[model samples]
Target: MRLLGFGLTGLVVLLALISLVLGPAAIGPAESLYALFTDTGTPLTLVMREIRLPRMVLALGIGASLGLSGAAMQGYLRNPLADPGLIGVSASAALGAVLAIQTGIAAHFAFGLPLCALAGAVVGVSLVMLLAGPRGSSLTLILAGIAISSLAAAFTSLVLNLSPNPFAANEIVFWMMGSLSDRSMSHVWLALPLMVVGWALLGSLGRSLDALTLGEDAAEAMGIGLRRVRWQVVLGTAAAVGAATAVAGAIGFVGLVVPHILRPLVGARPGALLWASALGGAAMLLASDVAVRVVLPSGDLKLGVVTALVGAPLFLHLIYRTRREMA
Candidate 1:
């Protein structure tokens, strides 16, 4: 497990460093590294500090959060099909971003979209929590999440349909597709605190989740409070995924894909899978981000689109494997 953990961590670090240097600019890796640390007052330094650095940071943080949250959710539910969006936070955040764009708030202010998106996430999670109640079962939680997610998706679609500005509609569509472009350190600061809190909450669930593999009754007998675990899963996912969707627009599948891929590697232990997925997710997103710039330097390619394209095939394979195992 230590070797696997170290390997995944190293992969994440390597991809992040590559992300920093693989932009469209013709800067060499040596020069990029030099500019990243020195205040040389050059354009290269500005690009490194302002553009690449924040994008890299956001990708790392957001990806890790998504991966961790996904593992936590699947562990709590004991279902491989589960992902962070099962709680409606992502849809709610997207609704918030849609409203911002439709109301021209996004056009008028830089942070309006993300702020509103974050607010929507909070509201969505609150609604789910409220509807699920304090001691609701996992089934009830799933139902509540589905209801909230459906409502938010409906509202988001309505906003797009009612939008009078084609340009704004286009912008909303692209934003929903997700990208790491044009993000700054301000965006990082805006999303990081919540991500950290979410990480702490989710990471602490390692022991609880490991116990949970023995079934709820068995886990409780082992002194694991299922209620506490539920709260951590819900709140941690909300904070982590909400903040990520707010800043990066609705990047999907990192949560779904990373945990699924790493599950077998960790001997199907949810506790170990948590951190492994975090590192794998960070590497995945960083590699994807670099690929976009390298493959389509002249055109805009959204990060989420690439993820979805890659994740869909893996998801199909997962389903196949599950069906065979069941058989």
Candidate 2:
């Protein structure tokens, strides 16, 4: 486990460096590093500081959030098939972004899209909690999340359909597909605080999740408060995922794929898996972002599209394996 953690951490760092250096600009790696630190008011400095740095930071932070949340969710539910989106925060955030685009608010204001998306995520998570009620079971929580997700998705489609501006509708569609392009330092400031809060909440759950793997009765006998744990998982996931979606749109499969890949390496211990998956996710997303630049430098290829292209095949294999085991 220690070795695996170190490897993943190193990989994340290495990929982060590559992300900083690799871009449409033909700057050399050493020059890129120097420019990043020196900030001599050169165009390269601006590219490094204003563009590459924030994108790398957001990728690292959002990827870590998704990976940690996925591990936490799977741990709490004791279901390998579970994903971060099962709670519906991502869907709601998308709806918010879609609304901002369709209504012309995003076009007029720089921060309008992310702000509205954050509002939508808050409403979505609040509704999920309310519908689940204070004493609701895990099953009840899942059902409530499903209901909210479906409703938000329906409304999003409605907005797209009713949108009068073809350009707005096109923008909405592209944003939903997810990208980190054109994001600024302000976006980093806007989303980082909430993501940190989420990291704290979810990171603290390692021990409780370890206990949960033994089943609820055993966990309760061990003095673990299942309800508290449940609340933490929901709120932590919402904060992290909500912030991520607010800025980056709905990048899928990081949460779903990272934990599953890292689980066995951590001896199937959810506690150990959480941080490991966080590192793995950061690395995965960094690599994907790099791929976006390398594969389609001139054309627009979304980060989410790259992730889905990689993750969807693995997901199908997981399903096939799960069904075989059940049968």
Candidate 3:
């Protein structure tokens, strides 16, 4: 397990470096490395520092958030299908950001957008918990999440539909599709603090999650506070995923895909899976971002779109596997 963890960390670093080197501006690997450290104020330096650096940071940060949160959620809920997006947190965050854009709050206040999205995530999680009941089954929680996601998505569409300016609406639509292109350091700064806080909160629950694997009754008998664990999972996911969506729009499937892929390798232990998922998620997103640049050097291909194309099929396969096991 330690070896695997180190391997994942190394892979993430390698992918991040690759992301730094690849771009339309044609900076070589050596120059990219040099420009990253010493800012010569040249185009290469500016591109590396201002443009690609933040994109890579956001990709790493956001992907880790999704991955960690997803693993934590699946662990806490004891559900294989649990994900940030499937649970409605990402959709609610996106709705909050969309509302901010629609009402011009994001334009007026520097921190208004992410704050609103965070609030929305809190609300979304609260609703899911409330609807799922204090001791609802996994199926009940998933159903509740689906309802919340549908409702939030509908409202987001309505906000876009009612916009007075076509151009503004277009911009909103593009942002909703998700892209790390043209992002600056401000975005990295905005989301990083909240994501770190979220990581800390979630990472603290590893032992508890390991306890949870023995079933709720066994976990509680061992003095694990079930209610507290749920609260931590909800708030942690909200902060990390909310900030992620606020900055990068609604990039999905990282949380879903990374955990499932790494779970078996970690001996299906939720506690150990947390950090592994974080590193895997970062590598996946960085690689995807690099792929985006390579595939459409001059055109636009949203990061969210690329993830969905991959994630949707994997989701179906998971469903099939689950059914087979149940049968």
Number of the top candidate by lDDT? 1
> What are the Cα lDDT values of the candidates?
0.93, 0.91, 0.86
Candidate 1, lDDT over the whole model: 0.93
All candidates: TM-score: 0.98, 0.97, 0.90
For candidate 2, lDDT tens digit of each residue in 180-201? 8888999999999999999999
Residue pairs in clash, model 2: none
Predicted structure 1, TM vs. truth: 0.98
Residue 173, model 2: Cα distance from true site in angstroms: 0.6
Predicted candidate 3 versus true structure: per-residue lDDT over 210-295, tens digit per residue? 99999988999999988788778877887888888888888878888889989989999999999999898888888888888899
* lDDT value, candidate 3, whole model: 0.86
Model 1, span 31-142: residue lDDT tens: 9989999988889999999999999999999999989999999999998889999999999999999999999888899899999999999999999999999998899999
Best by TM-score: 1
Candidate 1 vs candidate 3, lDDT winner = 1
**Candidate 2 — number of clashing residue pairs?**
0
- Order the candidates by TM-score, highest first: 1, 2, 3
